[model samples]
Target: MSVVSTDAIDKWLLNRKWAPRDLSAPPAGSDLAPVPGDPGMPLLGHSLEMLRLGVRYGLKRYETHGPVSWVRAFGITIVAAAGPEAAQVVLANKDKAYSQQGWTYFIGPFFNRGLMLLDFDEHLYHRRLMQQAFTTDRLRGYLDRIGDVARRGLAGWRPGERFTVYPALKRLTLDIATDVFMAADLPAADSERITRAFIDTVRAGTALIRLPVGRWGAGLRGRKVLEDYFRRSLPAKRASDSDDLFAALCHARTDEGEMFSDDDVVNHMIFLMMAAHDTSTITTSAVAYYLGKHPEWQEKVRAESLALGESPPDMAALDRLGTLDLVIKESLRLVAPVPSLVRKTVRDTDLLGHYVPANTLVSVTPWVNHLVPEYWPDPRRFDPERFAEGRREDKVHRMAWMPFGGGVHKCIGMHFGMYEVKYLVHELVRRFEWSVPSDYTVRWDPTALPIPTDDLPVTLRAR
Candidate 1:
């Protein structure tokens, strides 16, 4: 081979589409060290590179600038902190330097006043009220209904040569969200429209432009559609004693005699429903893709599911899915559904000794932690055994394997999401044999939540 230079490789990876710029110097006599980074391009920054490379782009930044650095992307300067150490400082937030205000610049319009958008005492208050809906008893009830919906939805799959799995999983999850959460009698067309609306609203958050003609406009309209639907249904939910999530929210209360208002109920329901279906779909799809690629592991999990019998696993039965659980955990580490979290510095702060100014956009990337070799050996491989009882690589660091994130903002629905995935995957392994070609691979589109660009097709056959 001809000569290949290190500089050439760095140039290609840092393509940035243009030259990198240095961030502003630290304030006079701040004592903290100045952070090193490349700002990436001019106006657009590294937005396009990020959209193209997904979490993989973080590697380029980390390799070039270490754990703490400043870079420009998506029309703003962001302080990027990678690996477990950086993740710890941000998630722990011992000094209260970061605020949820950072997300307002992105998703506030579509998910206004949702739990993740609130902060400090307000966030705690809302989280406390919402906790009533996810009690242990309610979870058992939700699991029962989820099994029913999972059976009905999965039964409709045709088992084709080129089965587009992601869309199918997406549809199944939305059905679960609507049926278990809403418990309303809706026409097929109405539910379909609602699903399209949720898609628009979520996609519009990062749209380059907000003109009514594109994803932005459609998202605005979608938000109205959802708000109207939930508002109209609010009266019935408040009046009835239904056990669904919607009614639960309407009646949720604390021991101190607190409850949600009409607007509070509506806002929460919209956000919870979007989170329930979309993220679950992503996690479940990842589990399937991994199982398909590694047939030995597929058969391993399949045998266990088959041993459990097919009568819809109860909570105890779900707990017995040890192999499946390990596989799910590994898939989560390899492909974090949310990947990175955003925050804004409320005051000046130092991330691992690098000075960051007030109001600066900050990103703590858990995806980076998942792949760092020190935390996980063979991190890129499909190795669920890393999470086995004795091998527990994830235990090396508290934040090393946070697929649902951590700290106070950790996902509220994570427990339910796990149960939902177990039920769905249990049913799937029992009913069919699936696989991808040995040479096949899928690319996740980073435009939103890292969905498969090709919709992730695989070969499906009836068991």
Candidate 2:
């Protein structure tokens, strides 16, 4: 009888495609001593690990070292910080010391200095203008617009057919963002064009080697395509104030009466579209995967949808859908859309009792904290009840649930994101009964958020 070799088994589990062998060691000059595990290749750092393995590497490092560890990725030194205290210190206490510009620098040439990429006063100024678009009254208006688009998108899906939900949901969200934010009726063809451009752009963010005329070049070309397309639409969008967020941007101003120039509006619109569509797509897919795998939770949400009925439920009704809310929150915890928050140290600072040198890249990984046992029980299980009343797995630590991130820089469209996912799930459960295949397994692609490696296979039946 032939026996399986332990090395072969180890190699099989650590498949280089998903898990790189090069990331199995830490770099010198970096104080990753607090944490154990590989930080990845020389000159490459943990960049590939961050892209391929998602949050597993950080969690392992945190589990071994402590709340803080140092590592290098993509030729940059990163300090991985975990735990509630660490989270509070980084996100709340001293944001000025940590800038979001470090991670977004690559995308800056493509996305421009959008809100999330800006720091200090510039971030504040832009955030103030963006806030107007998400006001209570504005969100109510967006609810009507978002609901119509969501329902229409769901209605178009044929029941019982095995389709890739991520791409479809991405198309759906992109269309919704364009219509609700730009007041632009992007035909399916144009929507696909724009979505493809974004996919390429985000893919470029994770590419290690920028070959001559490679993904990076393609991304730059894609950005030009996006910028040109939006620039043409700017005049029409700016011609009159429409209810769409693009319209809001056209006329948005600070207290000093400053407003975005036509160029500013175009760039900002592209950035907003990318952020909303990508995050919404990932989070929606995660919730769908969990619901498909667990029919009990699916039924719980279906009943809530039934109560919601044909009309778009008001904010109160939407908020009262507590069971569904818990499931969405739990899904985010399990596979956060943005697994890691990257910041560059503006000044030398001490983090978790270590001297972090200036220019060091500080990374706070939500994927790690989400799995830490101290904050969550059975960190690997799909227990939405943990988020429900009494259990409150998230309540264990403020930083425990950072799927949407935290602080003033917290996702401005968070409530909107939650509402969109909740409504999308409500509509899906109301229209169809679905479940994951018996032998289905999900692999995470850490490149562009945590997406199902296999398109999230599911069997759907008409209700």
Candidate 3:
């Protein structure tokens, strides 16, 4: 594993004819126009800058070169699309020009054939069949498990000065996923191992050296662990008629008699499990950070949560927390769980008047778009009222606020994920009131999924 070098990976990729085409020449005297802007540095390109600045790098590039610009990153030239218009084009995918294969270059090794990785009719087919797992009845069952798990998890947290909320919330969400999705309660050691596996799998996407070295090697090992674990558990899930998501996927069928194979069930389970827990953890952590910064909003949301009584609120009751809903939306906008949506051109395409050739990687930056002043006024401010009835700023455009993505490939487990976050927050506010120092601001490490660099420390007082 240590023998594999970055240069070796690059050479291997090039030798296998899997490397991106070199688009160094200008498209002159042709009707099709070349994408404008600079590809920073050699080999590495703007990837280092992107990691350092996060969405701000895209915002800067957008400022210099219009909505559509080409930038080299992650060993390829990506057509960076900024603002809501670009998001509408890429996400809507009206012409069927874009393919989900772009994600294949990144996470496919770990989460291959996952729903997000499927394209065209195949994606629709699997999504239709999987819809049964997230129906109202199923979501309600998930909520029950979430509430019980949340209470148990929160009870363990010693409320006092300087608590790192992100890690606690991350662990809590993973536990909820294990119970609600897997329908099995493993011992603490096993649960911890599974959780670390998930973390490694996700973090693998942004490894600087794609070769099997250090963390990247662990990620490859973790993927195998997950594959073996899921394969081993498949028999039990299929034999039992448990209402958990694992069982649902095993038995899920469409009106047309479509059903997933055993392999399909295992693959989808791994992807869904990662998506369900990690995104929920990010959203919940952001909400906690914002609520801590703004006590007035915290008190307002807490009041709403308190009205629902002490016991865990059901899915229906959870929806009634309007203020909390606003906060969640704002938090999602602020710290998008999966910030940028990547797509590869299946054929030659025209995006915002710039010509993109086939097999090109196109990135639509929602994280930066969410902060654009034109779309979102006072973008940096933590104003949840932007999503309130009177404002409804998100309605400015169909793709303006796309934290869950849009069009055919929007997150299928969105409802369940939201319910999980709201339930956890409700339990959190009811049990303790937390706050961060006014002068402090979170530093998001955007290497993979956006996570706080400092683990999000805050002072917690028992209610």
Best candidate (score: lDDT): 3
Q: Which pairs of residues clash in candidate 1, taking residues 3 or more apart in a chain or in different chains? A: none
Query: What is candidate 1's lDDT per residue for 283-346, written digit by digit as tens?
Result: 8999999999999998999999999885779989999999999999998898888878889999
Which stretches of candidate 1 lie above 4 Å from their native place?
1-21
lDDT of 1: 0.86
- Estimate the TM-score for candidate 3: 0.93
Worst 10 residues of 2 by lDDT: 17-26
Model 3 C-alpha lDDT per residue in residues 1-463, reported as the tens digit of each score: 4588745654443222122333434356556557876656678877776776677666777776778888778888788888899889988889999999999988988998999999999999999899999999888888889988999989999987889998999999998999999888889888888888899999888777889877677788888888899999999888998999999999987877778998899899999999999999999999999999999999999999999987668877888999999999999999989889899999888787778888899988889888888889889999999999888999998778989998899999898889889998999999999999999999888888999999999999898
User: TM-score per candidate, in order?
Assistant: 0.95, 0.90, 0.93
Clashes of each: 0, 2, 0
What stretches of model 3 exceed 4 Å from their correct place? 1-32
Clashing residue pairs, backbone N/CA/C < 3 A, model 3: none
Candidate 2 overall lDDT versus native: 0.77
lDDT by residue (255-287, candidate 2, tens digit) is 799887887677777788888888888988998
How are the candidates ranked when ordered by lDDT, highest leading? Answer: 3, 1, 2
Most accurate candidate by TM-score = 1
Better of 1 and 3 by lDDT: 3
What is every candidate's alpha-carbon RMSD to the true fold?
3.3, 4.3, 6.2
